[model samples]
Target chain A: MSAPLIELVDIEKHFGPVIALNGVSVSVKEGECHCLLGDNGAGKSTFIKTMSGVHKPTRGTIRVQGAEVTFNSPRDAMEAGIATVYQDLAMIPLMSVTRNFWMGREPEKRFGPFKMFDFHTANKVTLSEMAKMGIHLRSPDQAVGTLSGGERQTVAIARAVYFGAKVLILDEPTSALGVRQTSNVLATIDKVRKKGIGVVFITHNVRHAMAVGDRFTVLNRGKTLGTAARGEIKAEELQDMMAGGQELAALEGSLGGTI
Target chain B: MAEANQAAAPIKDERVREMSPLRKALIRPELGAICGTIVVFLFFLAIARDSGMFAPEGIINWGTVAAQFAIIAVGACLLMIAGEFDLSVGSMIGFSGIVIALMTVQWGFPAWFGILVAFALALAIGALNGFLVIRTGLPSFIVTLAFLYILRGLTIFISITTTRKTIIGGVREASEGDPIAWLFGGKVFNGLFVWLADLGIVDTFVAGPKAGQPVVEGIPMLMIWALALIVFGHLLLTRTKFGNWIFASGGDAQAARYVGVPVNRVKISMFMFSAFCATVFATCQVMEFGSAAADRGLLKEFEAIISVVIGGALLTGGYGSVIGAALGALIFGVVQQGLFFAGVESSLFRVFLGVILLLAVILNTYIRRMITGER
Candidate 1:
């Protein structure tokens, strides 16, 4: 097969003497949805931060487009077309929609030594990109804090795609969302995938991962359990693995019911 | 594809709610400031009808006072938007003024060179303030509060050792014959004021030092600086990439860092900018008044923040405008002069201040709720 868009081989991260991520290998191909599933304290955050270049791996190699790459900062990773939409979506709620859409990477036109942000281009692109995700905002001037959780996630996703991100990492985008909002975010992810971008979906919900994920890499503690292609693993099986099956059964034997 | 496409179907839904232009205008936070200004003006006019509060002299009178707080408020507005505070701003004005005085007035250097030295010092101290907050992770309120006293004490000591007096006088003479001094210190559009006075539209407000001469020149340089800054500050806060960084860093520092905004640098620059404005105010004070007192600019920090808050900025951060803050300063000026013109107790303006601040905040909340469409 063609080389995956990005690959992490046996990545390990350490904080002091404690190991956070131990030899976890994962990869995502172009247009593929690779869901990284783990429960609380499963080191999912560490893995993504490493991938997004916020933290350096103590061991192993990260490859972008089949070439070995070492990222010293998040900007380096972003320049390589990797964008992370953090749980907060990296958005300013009180700012206008267009401003938040182009916060860090704003478009500008120069007038001599004086440079001015190109509000026209920013506003137009923000509206059109948001429309592609089925969100028709009334005005790009509205504050983002007024948007619903679902719409805000869509804005983040649209922003990532608009900025030429080939690898999009969504870290728990739907964690704080309601049922409808989760569905909305899943839909936005699917639209992003069709745009030929690779996605790293991080969540603990088995049903969510099954619904949108093409490949699943289950993590427990700091280690990866295994990888499963679509339909290779059942939803209940994934849930059991996440719940630590053997330990949960022993606790169930003692309590005899849900605690 | 099927599920995601389901959400994309009918992408152009009429469900995208649109607000009318009038409703949009009504929801602006500055709307409160605008209305308050008009109400205060009408109230003052009713009480001080014969007083010069509305005429050219009254305007120039209150305007210069408003300029002092307004200039500082602009700095406070930007700093507040970036999620930081500088209680040392008032002290900065005094300390920098003393630095200017000791350099030029006491030591006999050109005013321009002394002003330049003061600028360098103010920016350096501002950088130190930003560094201490960023490196040590202390709240800016505490950091700057400490500098407030430190600078005040430093100004006093510098004055005592250099000139053997707490007030450094004769700055106007020290600035004389320097071309650059005109940029920051003196009045402009003198012919306009003279013409208006000749037409009897404006009174010959003050006697010039010479006989039969009206010293009441055109608008004070302080007023001109305040207006110019209002324009420049608004554009810098609204129309530049740097402005976006300021909003993002203040809005969510972690998120801004993740997005490569260099949040620390954005905040640090804002500290320096605040110092720059304070330095400007101090320079004007020194040039116009021809002296610097150690006790100059006392309680000006609270006044500036109050102006910003009255302008509808949250003390916590991430939302505000310079125009709003400027208008807030104007409100302060009108109430101050209105009470003075009416011959009422000067302290009664404090009562007016409390009422105005409360009303502005309440109105701001109401407008925000309406804009957000909350029930």
Candidate 2:
């Protein structure tokens, strides 16, 4: 319905003799959920890493809002409004929630040569932001390690959102979560989409992808196998394609007699 | 149906329910340190009473030692809290004292001017240490260790060249009626310098000792200096944004950098603070002893670090308090002097100190676990 916020064209990456990504391309429209589905060794990791400025593509162009650009570091990506939430969350567990929220960007009260952290303002703002994400944290002073995995993910997402992320790239947000927790994360994705921010949801679970994804791109052996709209494909068909379709079916048939 | 019935059943385990408030309080993070402090204090009191160590003179002597250690330890704590170390503090003190002595006694410079020059030199040295550590990205331990030797060697070379003597001898008193000398060494002259004297406020608050004896007044100027530093350090650590960045950098430097904190700047400033503290302590020592030696503050780095660890600071950085470190230095001072009054052998005091160090490590680890709620 609207122009894409980010579009990768003919992206290719190579490491020595190994080809990590081969002509992988995807487009994320504004306010849309674009799911990248791939199994192990399918080049999803490489594509995301390239997008987040962890690696440079050997060939292809990355256009942000219709303008081609090159990123030298994660800071460059952040400056371009592309925020990535890595699986590890990039949070120090021992620190208080408020400290983690405003770790590098703390509000200061200056007095001559002395500068003090404005804890009162930081704590109030952090709590309010978390509340906006439907997270009712008991205290902003609680150590992040004391929170659950789901809650920690929420905090990271909320932090990214609060810091003015235009495009949020989630690396397997629900991969480690339980059933109910996975549902919670899906709800979070919906909330992000509603905010008119493009979301690139990276996951291998076909059913989970089908749940929140409006458009899907499937990768097989470092290349895109297929791209389909939600209404055009069923979950079973997506699963079949993900499992290599005819080749897997033939193998299953060949092994059916032996089993 | 059987699986559903099993899942529906409520577990009645007492341990899985809830812990009592008393149990929770017992597991508080600060409890271990608080208990250790009290136990150590009582142990010293008991031993001191048995050895006639509770005398007023003994108290005064220990107070002086504690003040010395506490002042430097406060600065060391700040550095460690920011996740760095300064091994050159001992040498910095030696160098600062040497500078003051050479300026005042040899060059015929006024005492006030000598102190000012010495402080400026110290600041330069501090800035150098900070710059090197931040730029190189090497561990502070190696950098400061190298600086310690370099500073010590420089002090020796300067002392030998200036006085044609290896020791440089003691400080010479200023002539009476010399305004500069009075500013540097005088008691009370209604001047800004006197008002800024280390223990001026404490002396006013606490009445002077009995008429004849030199009144061991309220607090030593050195003690007041240490206390003021403690208060300043506390404000820096808790009340400031830079303080938060320091903790974050120490706790997880990568995360701190990811969040846009200037990690290098914070670390460099921390090193400078550590060196500045050493310089201040050196000035106080020169004034108190009325002399300077090439080895004035030898091994003080170890004492400061030990005091910081005992005060509940983690060597890994990110969690500590200046007040805690000052208390730790006080503990060390009390133990050293109290052992003498308790009739303990001087050599055996080392063994007692070793025990205290081990206990402190254990207590620190225990407190960390409590804070993290680890079983």
Candidate 3:
């Protein structure tokens, strides 16, 4: 219906003669959940890194909103409204909820030689934002480490959204979560999509992909096996593709049932 | 239906047991410090009573001494909270004091001008220390240690080269009653120096020549300075964004950077603040003594660090309180001075201090684990 928000054309990455991403192409539209699925050594990490500006694709062009761009640093990506919530969450758990929410960007009031942080404003903003995400925190002064895993992920996602992230890249947001926690994270993703932000959900879970993903791209052996729309592919077909069906079939033939 | 509901609820109840109040309190790391402070206070009170040392005058004297250490310890706490150490604070004090004395005695500068120049010099040295540490990526401990020697050597070299007689030789000598001398060296009433004495609060204890009369007139201006610093330091560490950044930077520098915090700048500024506080203390010492020597504040850095650690600051940084550090300094000063009043050998104070330091480290480690929920 609209031009892709981010398009990776012929992307290639190599690490000292070992190709990590070889001629991979993908496009993510605005307000859509694009799932990148692959087994180990399938270049999923490399592709995400390239998209997040941690690495420059050896030979490819990245276009955002139909404009070609090249990123040399993660900061560059951030400047372009691309924010990544890493697996570690980049949060200080011992810090207060409000402080963690406004870690790098804190509000301040100045009085001549004396300047003070505006904790009042920080608390109000963090609480209201968390409320918008359907999280009712007991106290803004509570340490972040005391929060559940799902709640922490929500905090990170909320921080990115509040800071005007147009494209949110989540790296294994549900990997360490429980079943209910994973569902909660998926709900947050759905909420992000409703707000018209492009989301790149990177995961190895097929059920999770089927839950909120609109498009799926399977990567294998540092290359793309196929890309399909939600309605065009079945969950079992995607799983078989991820496992390299032809290779598995050949191995099964060689092993044949004994007796 | 009733049996099935009870069976399901029992399983859920067993999975999420509520924590007891005692369990919660025991798990808090700061609770240990609170208990330790109470125990230490009771011990001092007991010793004071046993030695007939509970008089108001005795309390005032001990408090005055404690105030001095408390003030510098506040600055040291800030430095430690920011994940840096300033071993040169002691030397910076000596350097600032000497600078002020030389300016007044040798350069014919007014007392006010001397104080300002000394402070500026101290701030510069502090900035330099920060710059060197940040630029070279060296540990602050080593950088400050080198600075300690450099500043100490400079103070000695300057003091040797400038003589009092040589300074006044080339200028028209003013009388002893000149306003500058009066301002710098004047006494309040008949016995106490004006700046070094507290009049309003201490006046109540002053007795008019009766048996067991209070001997001391008032608290020192140095003590007042220490109190003010403690308040300001508390505000800086707890209520400000800079304070939060300091915590974040010390907790995890890489994480702080990823979030776009200027970690290096926060650290360098902390070093500068430590030096600035040292200079302030040095100026007050010089004014109180009416003279400055190359060794005026020797080994004070160790006392400040010890005070901070004892007050509940973690060496690894991330968490600390300026007020806690001031209290820690108070504990040190009281024990040292109280030992004298109790007829204990002065050298024994060192042994007591060492034991206190060891206990503080053990307590800090335990509390840290508790706070982090680590086994």
Candidate 4:
């Protein structure tokens, strides 16, 4: 429909003599969930890391809002309205929820010549934001480590959205979560998409990806097999594509059992 | 619509566990130190109260000793919370004192000039320590341990070569009338103490050359420095964004970096601060003693860290409290002097130190487990 919010064209990444990613292209439009499905060691991590500016692609053209850009650092990517919620969630567990919420970008109030962090504003903002994510924290002063995996993910996602991320890249957000947490994360994705933000959902779970994903792109061995719209690809077909039907059968036969 | 409804109607979520206020308070980093201070105070009151340990002069005695520990404890507390250690702090104190003595007494520089030079040199070495740790990715314990020996050796060598002795005197005369030296070595509120003595509010000398003079002169600059540093450290760690960065860097440095925190800068600045505190302690010591000894601050670094640990800082970092560290120092000063007041063997003070440190560590472990929900 409209021009994609962000586009990565012909991305290639090499580590020394090893090619981690080769000629993989993906794009996300406004208010759309683009799922990148891959098995373990399918180059999903390297691809997302490159897209998020942790590593520069050896060859690629990245476009944000139809303008060519190069992100030299994670900060640079953030400046371009691209935020990545990594798998580990990038949270300081021992810190208070409010402190972790406002870690790098703390709000400050000035008194005469001195500036101090605005704890009142920070606490209130954190409460409201966590509430919006359906996480009613008992206190903003509670340590983040005490939160569940699902709640921590919600905090990270809410932080990315609040910071004006136009294209949010989530790396395996539900991989370590329980089934209920997985559904909660999917619901969060649906909510974020409704707010007109582009989402890049990377996961190995085909069913989880298919739950909220509008468009699907399968990555196999550093190359994309194809891209398909929601109804065009069934869950079974996407699952088979991710694991590869022939390879599965071969492994099953070699093992003399179902896997 | 669901999100809007959820935000509009703030229901107490069933999943969100609420902690009792008592449990919450118990998890505070200062809890152990606070409880320990109260217990220690009560114990001493029972045994040493009639012995004049609670009297003005005795209070000042232990207070001064506590101030010594508190000054460096504040620095060590902040640095440890930032996920680093400065084992060289003790040696830095000795090194800084030697530098000041050499510059002022031997090299013919002014006291104020020498003080500034000592601070600059110490801070530079501190920066180098931070740089090496960051660049080599070495554990700070090893790096600073190396510096501890390097600095101690350098101080001794410099002293012996220059003056043919390890101790240098005449600093008091050289620093006489120097405004900066007075800030470190001199007393404050002298008129107030004298007025208190005249009003019979304080004990005064009843005979001899010092008759009518109050036994406790005034609040020494050392006590003031300790108090000021404690306040400054407490506020900085609790009420500032840099404080957040310090916690984040210590908590999970990689996570902090992912969020764009300047972890390296926060750490380096903390190292420099540790050096600054050591230099302050050194300057005050040199002025008070009217001399500088190459081995003056021997084992002071361990004392500072012990106070911080007793204050409930994790050895791995990410959590601590300055007030707690101050209280820990207070306990140290009191027990060290209380032993004498109670007529116990002075060497038993070491036994007390060892026992208290073990107890604090055990308490801290339990508190950490409670907070982290770990077994």
Candidate 5:
């Protein structure tokens, strides 16, 4: 419908002699969820890392808003409005939610000649932003470790959204979550997609991907199998593709079809 | 099902469950240190009250000693919170004092210049310590332990080579009128003490050339430096963005790096701060003693670490308080001096350090469990 907000064309990544991602391509349009489905060792991590600028692809053209760009570091990608909420979440457990929310870009207030972190602004922003994601915080001073797994996810997602991320990359946001937490995260994804922000939801779970993904791209052993629009793919078909069609069929036969 | 209701009305905010205030306070990093300080003060007051331990002059004695520990403990606390250690701190103190003495007394340099040189050299070594750890990906404990021996050997060798002895004197003469030296060695609030002595509010010398002057002269610059460092360290850790970075760097270094925090720089800077603190302590010691000895500050690094641990800092890092560390130092100074005042064996102070450190570690482990919610 509209020009892709960000595009990765023919991306290739190599770790010395081993090729991690081989000529994989994916793109995200505005307000669209592009799900990248891959099983273990499918290079999903390498692809996302390249997209988020943690690793420089050996071959690829990255276009952001129709302009060819290169990111040398995660900071560069963030400056280009690409924020990645990694699997580990990159949050300090012992720190307060407010502190972790404003970790890198802390707001400062000046008193005469001295400057200090503006806790008032930070606390207020943290509480409201978290609430917007349906997480009511008792105190911004509470340690992040005290929050449930689901609430921590909301904090991370809300943080990326609040920081003006045009493209949000979620690395298995639902992988560690229970069913209820996973649904909450899905709802958060729905909210983000509605706000005109492009989302790259990376996961191996076909059902979770099908829940919010508008376009699905299946990555098999560092190469894209195919891209399908919402109605073009079914859950069973995607799950079969994710498990590697023939290989899984062969394993099923060897295991006497118990699987 | 329930998720739909949660999305619709935020029912009761189950996620933000309330805990009792006492349960909350129990998890704080400073709770153990605060309680320890109170217990120590009460114990000393009960036994040493009639022994002049609470007298102003006697208070100054322990207070100055506490300040010494606090100065180094502040640096150690911050460094430990940043997830590193500096075993070289004691050697750095000895080396710094020797450098100042060698430069000012033997080489006939100005006291201010010598102090600057000592600080510069110690910081460089400190930076080197951080660099080696970062580059080698080794634990800071090992890197700094190596530096401990290197710096101690260098200090002794240099002093012996230059002056044929491991001790240097004439620092007081060389630094007599220097303003920078006075900042470390001189007393403050002299006029206030004088006025108080004149008004009979403070005790005065009864029979000496200094009769009518306050027996407690004024607050030593060492104590002021200690207090300043404690306040500065506390504020920097709690009220600044850099403080957050420090906590993140130690808490989860890889996570911090992924989040765009400069973990290497934060850690390296902490090592340098530790060296800076040791140098300050050394300068004050040399100035106060009017000499520098290569054997000075022996085992002081362990003392500083013990103070931080007693203050409730986790050995694994990412959690601590500077005020807590200062209070831990206060407990040390009081117990060390109070032992003598209460007619106990002074050597029992070492026994006290071992006992208190163990007790603090156990208490900290419990608090950590409370915060982390681990069994």
Candidate 6:
């Protein structure tokens, strides 16, 4: 209630002739799991990009830690304690897990014009950080590609939190995961939320959103339907809102006609 | 800061064999190249049948030529790991040799000065190649292909204009008394060869009346440079943050950028490093050959790329080792020289090379997929 960790007021995003997001507003509070629920092509990606400084809002204000701030790049957002773990995770499949965890920010030790990567620190940090996320890697030297989908997602999440993320944005982290893997990712989210970091879990699955989400924001066609707390909103109503209120009826009618 | 609350139950039912130490070593990208080296060496040894090809002399014979290809191949491997290509390397060899020849032979500049000038010019060209590729977002293949022609033509035009002949000679004589040329060209230690000669290790000096004089000479300096480059390349690729950046940039440039890697800078440096190596080869070659021709170093770029590919680097980018490239060069040299030792036709060498490349690539791809658990 006392100024959320990150607040977006009437956020709008556009790409030339396309309006991907319009007057959408959402805020994530400290130590809360706020799910951004939207279907495919519902501008979830564009919205997160805006939040993570990948894109500037066409019209709206973004407040972080109670201050209006503008982000020029992803680095800017990261510096301002916002980290995004995209679905792809942005990890090198061939590289070791430690390498991927510290991709852009590798530790280095220098001696007389010769600088070397500090594998000792990297491996130590990677193993411990991943363990803290409820996912213990066998070895830091193991390739990230070898890890399961849920584990990879957890690695990304852990890396974000390790690198200082007051607000974490996960873009469809469980979309491609299997049932067990999905639950594993949910467990990771729960662990992260307990650490007092604000989480923006982007997903389209109603059950997944309802599982750990403390607050839900439903978006469709570049607009937000509404935001509701877990106790306030009914599961049936949230499902209808995600389907665009009447979009599902229209789809059902079309299928009925074909039948 | 919280401890892992690992689930009590095992999740995966699939049978994944516990990886062993030996299995880990076998999956290394360089494994194929190492095996290929041994196979090729043994094949040559069997065919040579009591020839010196089994001895250090044979190693020297094949190694000298391998060194030439290895120098350039190391650069190709690095650039490939960084997810790019520079087809202009072969032409860069010609260009650098010509520039150095002109400056030292025609302009009478000190050989060291000429070498420095050529180095700077090569780095500049490399930087330009990188700039164009990065800024325009064009495939390096197309960009470097254009440079290949541009540099080749420039070399020819310059060669014809400066000297009446396309070939420039007397570089060795021109470089006489210049310490830099001597450092690059002159051999340091004669004791090992002298000892070998005394022990009847190598053939008695084959030519001239003085040839019977137990004529052990200093080692070829280019071989030293080649060996040095191997150690340097291996360390840089494995021990440095720059190496990690190269792999990251090559693996997925977009993803690397998303995580805040300086992908553009990494790529551009790789291009420059590739060209710089070509120039280094030229410097050593001109010092060794005593001459430079506009037509020098034709098709060397393909040879370098082939070596890198044989070393188990993916053409698509990312995931490679320079030590693998070194061994790949070794495989090439052994097979090539072994043919000569066995009295086989040289043209068949191309067929053998083609087969080896195909086999090596398939093996590397299969191994990588197995390791990554990708289909």
Top DockQ model = 4
lDDT tens readout by residue for model 4, A47-98: 9988888999999899988999998998999988899998895577888889
Tens-place lDDT per residue, model 1, B130-169, is 9999999999999999999999999999899888899989
Model 4 spans > 4 angstroms off: A250-259, B1-10, B15-23
DockQ of 3: 0.29
Worst 10 residues of 1 chain B by lDDT: B1-10
Q: Give the docking tier of candidate 6.
A: medium
Residue pairs in collision within model 6: none
Give lDDT tens digits, candidate 6, residues B318-365.
888898898888888878888888889999899998988888888888
How accurate locally is residue B216 in candidate 2, as Cα lDDT from 0 to 100? Answer: 35
Residue-by-residue lDDT tens digits, candidate 5, B116-182: 9999998899899999999999999999999999999999999999899999999999998997999
Full-model lDDT for every candidate = 0.87, 0.78, 0.78, 0.90, 0.89, 0.87
Per-residue lDDT of A41-68 in model 6, one digit per residue for the tens? 9889999999999899999999998999
RMSD values for the candidates in order, in angstroms, are: 3.2, 7.1, 6.8, 2.1, 3.1, 2.9
Give lDDT for model 3: 0.78
Off by over 4 Å in 5: A250-259, B1-11, B14-27, B372-375
Please count the clashing residue pairs in each candidate, in the order shown.
Answer: 1, 7, 0, 0, 0, 0
Query: Candidate 2, A259: how far from true, in Å?
Result: 18
Reference-based lDDT, residue B204, model 2: 30
Better of 4 and 6 by TM-score: 4
Looking at model 4 chain A, which ten-residue stretch has the lowest summed lDDT? A250-259
Best-to-worst DockQ order: 4, 6, 1, 5, 2, 3
Measured with C-alpha atoms, the lDDT of residue B330 in candidate 1 is: 94
DockQ of 4: 0.59
Error of 5 at A60 (Å): 1.9
* Candidate topping lDDT: 4
Best by TM-score: 4
State candidate 6's DockQ. Answer: 0.52
- Any runs in candidate 6 off by more than 4 Å, and if so which? A111-113, A250-259, B1-16, B206-209, B212-216
Error of 5 at B266 (Å): 1.5
